[model samples]
Target: MAEMKSGYIDYKGFKTYYEIYGERKDNGKKPLLILHGGPGDTHLYLLNYRDMADLYDRQIIFYDQIGCGKSNIPHQEDDFYDYDLWINEFFTVRDALGLDDFHLFGNSWGGMLATMCMLRDDTGVASMVVNGSPYNCQTWLSEANRLILYLPEEMQKAIAEAEAAGGDYSTPEREAAYMEYYRRHVVGCDPWPDFVQEAFKPENVGECFNVMQGASEFVMTGKMKDFNVLDQVKNLKVPTMLLSGTNDEATPFLIKEAYDAMPAGTEWVLVQGAAHIGNATHAKEYFEAVENFIERHE
Candidate 1:
């Protein structure tokens, strides 16, 4: 088993926490850098990749983006939640760790961030895997609305009411209704996993989530509400693999838009019976596909 080492990096005076699983071996492959979802999500849920590092003798990296998880939180102001700030942090962490070669894996918002990073600089990226990410906020909301209609009529009503109240998902009925949508499109597992639950704890929830992703998944009243990269995805020159679940909020249609926009030869995969976080609900298939993709590129 590879030993896990954890540490913090100082970036622009802010502290970002990171954990590395498995020491670099002479396997001739670069480390796999993981980017967690949420404009504020922690890297806790991504711990599933630790197994891949240990078993495959591959190095895996996980980091809590600034203002999330174990990282230091900046002042709670909307101005602090800039997309370029996080993108710069990604490069800072990569260079700080001396990762000249790496396979980038970004989930959800992370996937969106990864795309932005690759577009900004693709020099060091050997390959990329985008999981359950949205290329356009409008498309995401449209698909989410479509999915919401599939919920029970009462639940749909509750959700609509909650959204109308400015995303006030405080009532038990409203919360339950939101969870119904989450279970169907977010985790796709019953008895929500501990790591998934941990991500929403008070300390784990960062200002970026509210400032960039809005108050809730269904709402888009944030700075990133208009974020769209479909027009520029074609600029990605790296070998990329796009992954999404059959029931993901990043619906197949949206994923297809990204896939079709990417340069030829990019891969697209849909994990059946899984939702947004396929690495958690469908670990076997998810890791197998990831490992095979990385190996093929290597």
Candidate 2:
């Protein structure tokens, strides 16, 4: 087992939890910082990635963004969750940890946050890997809703009706229909791993997701609906590798859209037979591509 270190950093007035999964050394293998999605998924979902630290020379860092798992919930009533708040929170963690140089890996919304970091400043990021992430919120909405159109008609009606109703989307009918999409595009696993299940717990996605991503997968009515990083992605100088599953909710098309705007020489990999959480279902391919990208940059 890699040496584990856990602690908290101050974010506003709350404590943000973080962990490092390896003993730091002066080795050229810089640490890998992972960002989990949800504006709200906890670091628990991505703990399987500790292997990068345990097996390889790299250390793996995991942190729950404010209002996320293992961290104090930010003020929901005050509308505290937004892209700027999230991006700022990330820097606070990085600086507090003194990670002057590192590799970055993010999944789903986490991947979006990685891009936000590079957009703000690429100073300490050595390389970055984004899986099932979106470069533009509008494109993310279009692609996911497009995938929804292909679901069974019953599901289509349930989602459309529920979204149109714009009330509680967790109703039995709405949730039942969305589960179909979740199975097909989110986990792509018959029985989800315990970690994945934990991350999807209702409590795991709280006010942050409510304020940033809204209540349903079919639409993005939250503040992030206008978030788009593609225009600025073209100027990023860091080595970037974009990954997406062929069956992903992020959609191969949207991944390619982001890839196209990325700086020249950016890497793109599409895992076959995988979906949103490709790392869970297609670990070999998903991680090999990431390992290769990080090695090249190192």
Candidate 3:
């Protein structure tokens, strides 16, 4: 154990819990603020990166969003569940921790949030990295739905039948089928590790995920339905690295559009053998890419 420290910061009438890893040195190692995926997911899966705090001689800040994981979970009030609220909380965390300028890396939904944060303000980010992120919600829905169609006919039918029956997303058979889709697209290379499997279990918070990102990958009924940052990438104003795997659910087509839209100084790299979670799927290659990018910028 590296003797991690935990604390709570008050944000928007609620308390958000976060953990700090590795000791800060006088050499000015900027903290890496990590935003985990799943609007409702905790930071448990991202704990894998704690070593990066020491490896890169940097600090890693991992926090559970309001109403998820070890964070405060309230009921009967979904008004505070929007993405903007999360961004506000992120700023609060940054200011409270005195993170003047730092590195930012996020995956999946986390990646989307990181971009949002960067767009809002670059005062606290020295560099930005977006991994396996979607540029447009509509395009994501189209691609994800297409992927769903590639599922076994029987499994797809089972899911349709289950949904037709009612809101039975909790059914054992439906869960199994969903896991199959997740394995193929979410993790890419089959047989996800145990920590990834653990994340599959239902956390069952408010419908934050559904309200902010829809019920599944194939649907876009959330507030992000019209979200598109393609035109704004040129305004990034920060050194940015757009990374993705060939087989990612994000797909190279989407990532290429995003990269082309970025400012001229922005850079990109593709991980060959990995999928959406390329950082975890191809650790050495991924880390090297990250290290090289940071060295160039730093």
Candidate 4:
């Protein structure tokens, strides 16, 4: 039987909650740490990954980053919610866990943060899995706009009108439009898994997202308006794998851009018929791909 433990860490005055499944003892395989999306989606949705320990025999770790889930959210200026802060937080988690070497799985915003962390330090990471994420917000926004065109005419018109009227993404019409896009390109699953639903809770939509990534997935009027690391990713030599859905908001083509920019041997997995959050609906395929990639790299 795998062991399970949970705890909190004092990270720069805030409490960051983490959970570990499987023993961390020398088991020939390195542990895996997961980073969930939304910048505030907590680690609940990703709890599905616990099976990695049971099925693959590798330790699995999950942490609800500060400002979400069980972690304490600090009341600071909007400026506090930036890549530098999140990057430092990532290192703190690693240091606290004593994870000298491990695999990483990052979804959506988490994937972007993982890429950023890799750019800062790749020596200790055996390999990384970036899921439904982008390296550039500008490109992501552009792609989202393109995807918006495929929505119904009413949705397209509502989106255009909302943007023209100061980008009100909260209107009922606007929200419906967003949901239509989400249903088709985000989760794509009829009844969202409970974990995915947990990620959509109000508290999960915290300042990190509000200040850093704007109100909607399709907009970019936040501090990360110019976030882009495509130019520098070529410097990374880490064995990496990029995972995306066939119809993900992250887009297969954009994922290809990052793949092309990575080291020569970087891997890519495209989940057929899945959307943004493949793990939410296609766990068997998504988790296996991750397991296979990490197993080989490890």
Top TM-score prediction, candidate number: 1
TM-score, each model? 0.98, 0.95, 0.89, 0.94
- Quality of model 4 by C-alpha lDDT: 0.85
**Model 3 residue 248 CA deviation in Å:** 1.9
* lDDT (tens digit, per residue) of candidate 2 on 129-193: 98889988898889888998888898888898888888355678778778888889998886888
| Decoy 4 TM-score against native | 0.94
Q: In model 3, which runs have C-alpha deviations exceeding 4 angstroms? A: 162-167, 170-173, 189-191, 204-206
Could you give candidate 4's per-residue lDDT for residues 99-168 as a string of tens digits? Answer: 8889998998899999899989876899999998888788889999999999889999988887787668
Q: How far off is model 4, as Cα RMSD?
A: 1.7
For model 3, how does the per-residue alpha-carbon lDDT over 1-298 read when each residue is reduced to its tens digit?
A: 3558999988767788889988777765667788887677777666667777667777788988776776646663556677788888788888998988688888777888888888889896888888878777777777776777888987787667665654366778787777787667677655776666665556634357766766666666678788888877678877889888876788778788788888888888888857776655777777777767765665
Q: Which ten residues in a row have the lowest lDDT in candidate 4?
A: 203-212
Give the TM-score comparing model 1 with the true structure, all chains together.
0.98
What TM-score would candidate 2 get against the native?
Answer: 0.95
Stretches off by above 4 angstroms in model 4 are: 1-3, 164-172
TM-score of 3: 0.89
- After superposition, the stretches of candidate 1 with alpha carbons farther than 4 Å from their true spots are none
The lDDT of model 1 is 0.88
Q: In angstroms, how far off is 13's CA in candidate 3?
A: 2.3
Which wins on lDDT, candidate 1 or candidate 4?
1
How many clashes in each structure? Answer: 0, 1, 0, 0
In order, the Cα lDDT scores of the candidates are 0.88, 0.84, 0.75, 0.85
